[model samples]
Target: MAQLEQFTTPLDAVVSRMRALGAALPERDGVAVFNRVYLAVTEEVGRQLDAGRFPDPGAAITLDVRFAERYLSAVDAAAGGSRPPACWRPLFQFRRHPGVRPLQFALAGINAHIGHDLALAVVDACRSLGCEPAELEDEFDRVGDLLTTLEERIREDLMPGPDLLQIADPITHLLGAWSLERARDATWAAARALWALRRLPELAEEFTERLDAAVGLAGRMMLTPLPG
Candidate 1:
């Protein structure tokens, strides 16, 4: 394959990051870490969107939305007392960072974009399902409004900042504001988490095995109702 381009435009930035990650990962692993490399490349997609850098978007954008969906699942799992049940098709993996630190800003960035796409995805699906044309157009506009705000926030956050919002979300702030320290920390924390989650599908085989075991047990239990 051709070497990943050194990105100049914001659109290129996402692609370059993905290429960088593709190099970092081991070749033996399966689907689990596949998307992981992509996150490293696309970490800046939000920043680009915020800057009106969306250019020639394609399947990659939808794929990124899938990346966000995994974390939405993670957030849900976190809110509940259990990890969401693993599936071969579920596209993310758990990552154990070396230290406990706030990576919420990066998560916020990915989540923001994911949400932006999810709104669009709903409408896209509606259109695919033959929903009314005018209603679909309205939803498109609504989704556009949301994406506009999300992109703006991402851009603002990335700029250099002593601002409160940037401080509040250090991970994403650099898209608008450049901070060596925040970028470094994000490299370790936010960047790593996002990368790991993206490649989560690679862990599918192991997860599927574990899931099968759980299902087997559940099946046996179901064969005999609880005895008081």
Candidate 2:
């Protein structure tokens, strides 16, 4: 009960922050759109944690909080007019552009979160827990699965009605180029690689930078402005 309380306190705080952002920003604003989607996912994860869905409750809590902090940190950086990590720059930079669709904003946020944040979060959890990447694998997989399913729903809900959507649309093609499953897989690989290089701080930093830049490139592509 104490452990749950400890985790719930911080998790609840994060959710409250997201909720405030959702309420304050315009519905069509790209960051607001993505914030709503992410807040839903975060709330669901919190419920699962409370219901004892995770095998290692402590590890799960650690990873969940660490993962969320990365996103929240990006939000803080953007709000302060400071540069966030490369992986997150695109979403904030193009967030208000009328040409970018809501679905694009949601997916771009997921890309930055899963592709870059998750990998680093795994490392953070490992360091904090004094365990290993293997110890957190189950928690990672469970979280990834949730995000994977949510990605589908985000597409379905945000997609334009049949009259507005067509096979020839550029947004369709751009979205087709990215896959949450592939991104999750690559992130797992990156997590493992970072863990392996944990002893070499310099090498790990370089690897992380490359991963961030590559993911940012994908995000930039995903956010490509389209004709309204």
Instruction: Write the residue-wise lDDT of candidate 2 on 114-168 in tens digits.
Output: 9999999999999999998988999999988999889988888877657365576
Worst 10-residue stretch by lDDT in candidate 2?
A: 1-10
Report how far residue 207 has shifted in candidate 2, in Å: 0.7
RMSD of each: 20.4, 3.6
- Flag clash pairs in model 2: none
**What are the lDDT scores of the predictions, listed in order?**
0.37, 0.90
TM-scores, all candidates, are: 0.26, 0.93
Mark the regions of model 1 whose C-alpha exceeds 4 Å error after superposition. 1-74, 84-137, 157-228
- Tens-digit lDDT track of model 1 for 1-228: 999556444445445545554465444222213334235334555555555555423332543454445434543574465654332112222222222111223332333233222333433433345443233333333334444454455445433446664556433432333332332232223322332343475553454345334433322221221111
**In terms of lDDT, which candidate is strongest?**
2
